[model samples]
Target: MDHIIEAIASALNISVKQIKNTLGLLEEGNTVPFIARYRKEVTGGLDEEQIRVIQENYAYQVNLEKRKEDVLRLIEQQGKLTDEIKADVMKAEKLSQVEDIYRPYQQKRKTRATDAIAKGLKPLAEWILTLPRTADIEAEAKKYINDKVETMEDALQGAKDIIAEMASDDAQVRSRIRNSMEKYGHLVTKAKKKHTDEKKVYKMYYEYSERVSSLANHRIMAIDRGEKEKVLNVSIDFDEEYIINWTINKFTKKRTSPVNYLIDEAVKDGLKRLAFPSVEREIRNELSEKAHEASIEVFSMNLERLLLQPPMKNKMVLGFDPAFRTGCKLAVIDHTGKMIDVSVIYPHQPNAKVKESQRIMLDLLKKYPIDIIAIGNGTASRESEAFVAKLIKDYNLNVSYTIVSEAGASVYSASKLAREEFPDLHVEQRSAISIARRIQDPLSELIKIDPQSIGVGQYQHDLPQARLKERLDFVVSKAVNRVGVNVNMASAELLKNISGLNASCAKNIVAYREEHGEIHNRKELKKVPKIGAKAFEQAAGFLRIEDGDEMLDRTSIHPESYDLAKKILKELDIKEEEMGSASAADKVKEASVKKLCETLEADSYTVKDILDSIAAPLRDYRDQYAQPMLRSDVLELSDLHIGQQLEGVVRNVVDFGAFVDIGLHEDGLVHISKMSKQRVSHPSELVAVGDIVKVWVYNIDEEKQKVQLSFLQP
Candidate 1:
């Protein structure tokens, strides 16, 4: 345990006390979120993410200790546990180092070493690693030469092969090799356009490749897209000499032998055959996993912000899923997000009469009292937006329309839930309805579907299946937990994602609530087995039980906290009856914080986190970004005769260009050609997702809805 703590402290650059405290909190049934948020005094104020890192390192340290113990046991059983070996074992900090030290003593099944030992050449390989410059080294090999040493070319070659295998497989050598490869190897990828399909999605990646060391998250994803479609080949590379230095340094530093010449050649063969490919793959995979995690984190953060973005609220919205072949699917969603009505019109159908469809939309707009018409900005989307624009202007309707992201709406339409929700509706209609509902309540509706289907992650499908499932499940759980669930309406799938509420626990919570009445107070949750105080602690803040027995009960305020809150209410001369909705609850919360601060007698740093966590205490403890918007407006796609001033949103940033949404349903291209006024090699230098900027509409293609935009104007 002490060794594990030391290693964790070394790896993470934190004190042993911090690691021990974090582990203590973890052991005491506190979650990372709880320990990080509620136990600030216990953990010395480590944030959740920092605590998570400590937790990960602690686990790694534990595994390292177990591996060390296992190595000692295995060597002891082999009867090689000499006093010296026992002493060496005591000093091993990590599993890899222990494995390296135990390399020669480990049991073997027929390898080059076993073969060499059988051929009476075991000492020769040892001599080579020792680097002894004896003049009769060739003579020593001559004595062991034989038919089994098949092809100098015979004995020398056999000894060299055995030594290379031993050196390459030496855990120390491999670790060093891996480290060197990661530190020096360049991730290389290239276009394989010869086998490409123009019909495939992500055609932009047909000619892309970049080094892993310098690759950003978006670039890695782009290369992954290319490789996924068989349009690119990727690999990691580094200078051969660099790999040699790492292995030789470990070998000479550890061994007493003078085997420089032999070890050097052996390293070449070892790396060329084993270490290079394996280490390179590890480096690439680690990089990919890191990038994937970052991408998912960003997506999760963005989705959380988008979900919490004020809903258009009780206002009916018109959603348009536009297309050329099947026309458009339009749905009117009332404030409650029930599909009040749906219609199919042919405004974009090339062979149809456009004027007739225009009248249909105008009539619906006036009838529904719509607040916003969310147009799916996909193929034929701009034309449909144009059609809707003319309708709003012609009818003199007061409704506003905003383009909606239909990134994975099509995938949702084909899903079983979509099929069940709108059994009789056409696929296009299902998609349109989804488009509308996403705008209505993104978190509520999105929780019902798969995250990968939302198109925010990188290589989500290509990820290792088990790893992907674990990570995606984590993301879903965090999202569900962050946005609080309605006990009555949540699907089992959505319910299962609540923190500490697995499939079975979620089912029981629902079952218990259903079998009885609604959960009057969170204390009733104890009736469900395995949902003791611990589970409730993690799950309560994120679950909403509307109109519960207590005024604070319906909100995020934990029941354990009700007494303190009641005292505050009495002190403020306020009744529980008066503190119910958003405003009243907010004031009561502020008063409670003041009282709690006085009670705890701690610094704001200590008391603030706890107070903020006393159920929605009026402030969202979780992070939230500001809503994205354009700085300026582009009135028309064609108004840019050459250089027209426009405002745009940085929708998607890439190495090539920043795709900016400038009022058009289609996001225009700000090709790397015009990302900034300064010399820009990469678009990310001056912009990123959600940057609102003034850009010049450089080129307009009315036929394609592809307007080229630039940061600099002529």
Candidate 2:
């Protein structure tokens, strides 16, 4: 455990004391945000993401420690414990290594060894391992040669098979074989060319293969997909003599035994029949797990970024679910996002006139004066974008429209949340409304939808579900806490994600609000049942009050931290009651921030922490993504040539290249060479997930909708 803790501390470059303090705060019911923001004295001001990594790695280390103890116990029970073996067991860092060391001792069903022993071939096998010049192999084999062992040939054959099995099962052999394969195995994929006539799904992958050791995460995923489709037959194979020679050379250099020749033959046989198969399975499984981890990690990060996108500030929004067959489902929401009305417009219906749908939208536009239009990017979305784009231009409507990434709009529409929100409305209406609502408040709206359906992941569904859920949930929870919520207005769903606020507590808050009215002051919160000292300490500072009757009510200062805020203002000789207004606000807050840190006996980062906690700006939410760049003109699809110039946002950065969104349906890939003026090991060195810059469109495949953009100027 100490070793693991030291490893984590080394990786993060933080003190063990800080790690311990952070863990204690986490265990005592404070959230990453709470600790980072208010309890910075304890955590040394580690952000939520850093804290999550710490928490996850800390848990892994604890589990590894338990596994180490268990392995040690198992080896002792098997009478194989030695100082060297104990040292190896203690040094096993990963689960796989620990399991590998314990593998030989693990109980298994009867194999060739058991069958050979059953046939009385154990004595002959022992003789081979202790070969003496006086003993003849054939003479020793004759005694055990019978029906059970068959002929003298069967006796020797059985002995050979048992020896091979024993050699393969040896921990040292398995470890050597596993390591060699990881370094050298090539994943050879061949077509069941004859099975081509069967017309299975993997036809595309049948023609290609590569080294398993070097396969990239995305490529391995694609190959796995191809295999699943039955279009490819893939096999991972490697040269066994290479691995056998390496292992035998490393292990046998210590001894010059009388049975060395027999042992060599036995090892050769073991490499072919036993070691190769076991190692192949182990390597493939390891590669798959590595690929899964990479995919899940990227998915988890993207999900968090997408979920935390800034919400459209208090405004009534009209969401349009565009579809050709059913026309468009329109949902008009009030300032609080309550559905005011819903209707349908036959904008694309064959029998209907364009003018009729045009008039329908204009009427709603006038009625609502909607602050934003959320159009689902599915089905007739492009047409709808053109429709709305032209509508705003021709009529010069003040309402602006955003093309919402409505990946799970339909799924959420079909969910119970949709039913509860619009029970009387049709499924299409619910779906369209969800699309708009999601654009307005992505975190609140998307939480009702499964993250997988939101579609930013590489192989979300294929990932280990438990791992995937854990990762996605952590991201979501972190994002929710970072955004901070209006306890008075936030939905129960959103509130439930707050630190220390469970489903029951969230429901109680909502019910309490309903029974009374808008919570006028932070003090009013103390009256809520079960929201006692601990829960309040955990949740109060995170829940904001838009215009609470009390001035501190609107700030993120916890009720417990309030006295220090007053003391700071008093030190400056300012009255606390008058400090809430515009004239004294900044001075009082700055003083308060410093005073809070001083009170807590923390650092300058802690003072800045208190500032962000008290009043985070709207930019805090949207800053996670590439900032919006509204173009004055549109690039017509027909105007595009192979080489075009445009401005783009860095949607995603990776080791290979940067994906740039240039106001198009699909983002363009700018290979690493074209990324910057200098060399870099990763795309993130120059470009982040969201950075807007000029790009040159190098290629266009309209059929595939792949736009190639380069950051390099012409």
Worst 10 residues of 2 by lDDT: 610-619
The superposed Cα distance between candidate 1 and the true structure at residue 576, in angstroms, equals 2.5
Most TM-score-accurate candidate: 2
User: Which residue segments of model 2 deviate by more than 4 Å?
Assistant: 194-213, 246-265, 349-352, 572-606, 611-635, 648-667, 670-674, 677-693, 703-705
Best by lDDT: 2
Candidate 1 lDDT over residue span 1-714, tens digit each? 787788767877777888788898888876665565456667677765577677777777777767777878888898878887777667776554576667767777887656767777776777666666544666767777677765344666667777777766676666766665666666666567476566655555544444455677667776666777787788766677766776766666655444466667777787688667766666666677776766655554444444444344466778899888877889888888888888988876575658878878877876878887888878887777777777777777677777777877888888887887789988888888888877666666666666666654444565555655555555565555555676766666667776557779887887886788677766677788678777888777666666677566555555555665566556555566655445554654666555556774544544443334332433432235333341111256545566878776666654567777888656788888776656786666676555567888788888876788888776
Superposed by TM-score, candidate 1 places the C-alpha of residue 480 at a distance from the truth, in angstroms, of 3.3
The global Cα lDDT (0 to 1) of model 2 is: 0.73
Question: What's the TM-score of each model vs. the native?
Answer: 0.78, 0.90
> Each candidate: what lDDT?
0.67, 0.73
Segments of candidate 1 deviating more than 4 angstroms: 2-25, 28-48, 72-114, 124-142, 145-153, 170-278, 419-427, 488-494, 504-537, 545-548, 580-596, 599-637, 641-645, 648-659, 665-714
In model 2, the Cα lDDT at residue 698 comes to 78
